[model samples]
Target: MKTKINLIFPMVVMALFLFIGHTSAQPAIITQWTFDDTIEPSTGEGTASLIGGVTQHSATMSNGWRITDFPEQYVGSGTAGAQFIVSTEGYQNIVLDFGHRSSGTMSRWAEIHYTTDGGANWQVLANNNGDLTPHDVVYPFSFDFSSVAAASDNPLFGVRIVSIFSPVAFNPEAPDSTFAANTAYHRARTPGTGGNPYSGDGNWRLLEVTFAGEAIMPGGAEKLTIVDFNGGNIPELNVPFYLTVQTQNINNEPTAIEIDTEVSISVTSGTGSLNGTLAQVIPAGEHTLSFSDLTYDVAENGVVLTVAATSGMVLEPAISEPFEVVYPLENIIAKWTFDDTTEPVIGEGVASLIGGVTQHSASIGSGWRITNFPEQYDGSGTAGAQFMVSTDGYQNIVLDFGHRSSGTMSRWAEIHYTTDGGANWQVLDNNNGNLTPHDVVYPFNFDFSSVSGTANNAGFGVRIVSVFSPVAFNPEVPDSTFAANTAYHRARTPGTGGNPYSGGGNWRLLEVTFLGEPLGILPGDANCDGIVNILDAVTIVNYIMTGNVHPFCFDNADVNSDGLIDVLDVVGTVNIILGRVRK
Candidate 1:
């Protein structure tokens, strides 16, 4: 189980173990310095030896010895090796940040050496040949255990700086004097040449040297602020920072635990608290602390506070752990309908009369009577009456008309559509002669493909109309008597395909079908029959010439099953067409 504690709350949860007494690891501090001037001798007496330096000078430290600008000629002088004792034994890495400030004509070089049995005999670990120029900020030279022999057992080492070729005498005591004379005249002089002195005179400055080692800290209450709300003026805070604590076991093996958390601040009015949360797994190792936040403010100018663990939590070897939360996208389909309650009679010629006619005696005799025809009726008009439909773009308009009575009327019902919000209309279906009386079970389909462009927009509508001949109607005729009472049900299509009666008239709206397989040919269906076969070849050719085939033409034409529709497929199609082979 994972528990999430918001960092914003003032009360921070302390690690359970921190309350009890437990020893942890100590943090490491890496520092570097460059020596360009002469230094005073050591006041305390000890075995002091000059490892390497200019003018044979020497500097002493509590742990080890360092020499600046030392000549290479005195490698094994009297008691020099014995005095320079190696102190860096358990360090894993070292960084040498050194450079020279010179205006000479000679190349400069540096080398690092290691000694196991005192300093009697030395072995070169690394060397640079004229690679670094004077006055250049050479990057910190990082040296790993790979450069040392049996590094785990012998981590102690020494460094040496040498001037390869130089005309000016080098001075470790006074670096500025050698280059000062040539300040105006020899500005373009190369290293180790006249105009700028080298060796004991000037032309050299050592920047910094640093050592990095591992340390561990354990047993403490880790109070981490992921975010802080300074005040109402600056309310929201979102910054992520990492705190790594080191821990060691009885065997002296180092283990680090990294806590990656964010601090956030939400301030209201003048009072605000900082809150934070953990969102990543803590890894084992010597963890380092880093922060990346755009809105962080410190009260003091140069007093950056370094936070440390102080409670129950102790850095130690343990399993990794993590923190996060997970959520999904939401959507819905809404629908609305316009019933007779709102639209009674749509227009002057339209009516919703039911069970009136089975046949046509007159154009307006029965069957949803249309008083007017074509806006103006001529001598027993043959045109039909119109009824309009409005939609809210979401619905696919489908005109459903049930065939209650069967007879050959002078005209058939058709549907018209308008994309311009009823500004103009296009006949979706004109005189649907293909529909037969027996086809009553299946609604007449007019795919909205013809009006998809117009209907895809905001406002769209449909108009249902029936064409009949008023002059052709016979009052005594049985067909005429029943024609006025043609009753049918209107509705929308119930599948994925477009409006089936898009071009047809005399359709009514019904419940929508939200889910269904869209009507079209499946992939590799060449014959346009939803399958691949020899007929597919003929279909391909027909499509190529007439631009009429199923949507997935490429799937059907690529006979070799490759993802391409090229000449090879054409040849394969030709072969299939000639009955040379089967698909």
Candidate 2:
């Protein structure tokens, strides 16, 4: 499930940032003109609609629908015709493919014209003679424009396709009457360089024109995120596997042409970890990075894998967002719903809370709610609500909960915990960072196994403190307004190596669940003095002689860690006490 720890009871002023959120993948192909369809798609035309990976132009069946009038028809003069906009940032080649009905004369055929400016002028790239035989060869028509697209000073990539049907004069200039008039109904007007947008369609039909080349995308690839393997279809158990990295950068620019790069995988956190770098020159798009031979084993639980691209070709490295994979575990040590009860909603447990903590609809659904979140100031008042939980023998715990916030920029709240009865506190969130947006309240999760002193302590208590922040102004005394979101982001302490935030990071908290294995046995400390000594050895002897028995972390008590713990262990304990040999 999801998880939430304590809350930062901070109340403060206001500040906001214009966040477009984060950048995502860009379109691979700018525009494709296929005579079979429309110029744009239905509803999603604004972003360039796609049909089987090919972005379709509008399928104009109503106003501008006709037939190709072959290159033999009377055409217009000067580059003027249909226009379209294209965003070719990192591409460098111009490719064209067309189909003509006749083996027409070379000079009387159609031609392709391109422009960089909006369209006050035009330039010829190639003629339709290449594809005159109809689908001659898919890759037959192409031109290299490295000098054009690679110009660091220029960033424009617009083109207007026009046909030069018939010349006004065979030799000298013919009278204007000799040229086909496109305005006349049912007449095929020859297309050419320089004119107006084509209305009545006729002449050689343009199939597909592309402006593609190697695109040097920054940061490994784009929108580097993890998708469920096989669409969440395959079982994720003890199966041997190789992770498939869908390099969003299609061969279109998977890697800089002729340049090889190094790819590495590192497990920064969680139940599993990885360390290896692969030397590769990936001209192909999708790739497979093996872990089976790399010894990247995992617990039945899940792990977070992040890959980075290191290349000297570019100035900086490209790292990916944390990609998490959850291998659901069966054991749930304890669960708390805070659903109108101060007790565990699923398993047996209780919460010890303080400060502006109360039960309200802060979560929308009826549950335990805490407000005035993020303390009015930092320090002791930084606690909006707190709790103490014990994991009998469990380790690798999964903590999940629901959370919502308001007037928070980021790092406005914090979750703190102490396994040793509040003696010392640790920030549940490693450091300062705000990854969640406060547009709405939702479920969140993270593995708590990394925290110190968290496992096998029956009295393991936790505290949630609200740090002081000033992300809001005239924020009023925070009331029932801090709730739900259409987005997500919770504020973490600044300098924790996470995204930073000042204040206005108040929150509404609810439901928490902990999943882990119960501590199986007590340690060799038979006296429970937190240590194993000769006295414990005497106790074990007493148990044997008096028929008394018990299991401590039997693993720890078995000094030699041997299977036996009887008279045989007495000597071992004595040896440990004298420091002759440590247990």
Q: Which candidate should be chosen as best, given TM-score against the real structure? A: 2
Tens-place lDDT digits, model 1, residues 1-583? 1122232320122122111211132213233332223232222111323432333333322212223342332132211211223334444333332222232322344445555555557665554433444332222233443445443324244434444322234432223444331121122234343354332233333323333333223333233322221221221223333333234433344434444322222222211122343222333333333222322221111112223343323432222122111000010111112332323222211223221222122221122322222211212212333333323222233433323222222234556666665577777764343233321322333445444533223334554455442223232222223333232211231232222221122322322111111223233445433445656656666666775443334545667777755556667766765667765
| Per-residue lDDT over 1-583 for candidate 2, one digit per residue giving the tens place of the 0 to 100 score | 0011111210010000001111122223334444345554222111222211122223432212113322223334323334444555554443322222211222223445655663456677655442332211111234444556522112455544444443322221221333343321212223332222223233332333333434544544442223333333332333333443434442223333223434555665555555333334334344333333233444322344554555523312234344443333445666665555667755556676565454443332634555443322334334555666666556666666655554343334457776665676677752232324443555556567765456655556555545443233222222212332211223432233333232334455555666775444434554333567777887778765774433234555565666766776677777767777744
Give me the runs in candidate 2 sitting further than 4 Å from their true place: 1-290, 293-332, 335-354, 358-370, 374-382, 395-459, 469-505, 508-518, 522-583
Clashes of 1: 96
Error of 2 at 6 (Å): 84
Report lDDT (Cα) of residue 557, candidate 1: 66
- Distance from true position, residue 25, model 2, in Å? 37
- Model 2, 539: alpha-carbon shift in Å? 12
At residue 376, what lDDT does model 2 achieve? Answer: 27
Q: Best candidate, lDDT-wise?
A: 2
Compute the lDDT for candidate 2: 0.42
- Which 10-residue window of candidate 2 scores lowest in summed lDDT? 9-18
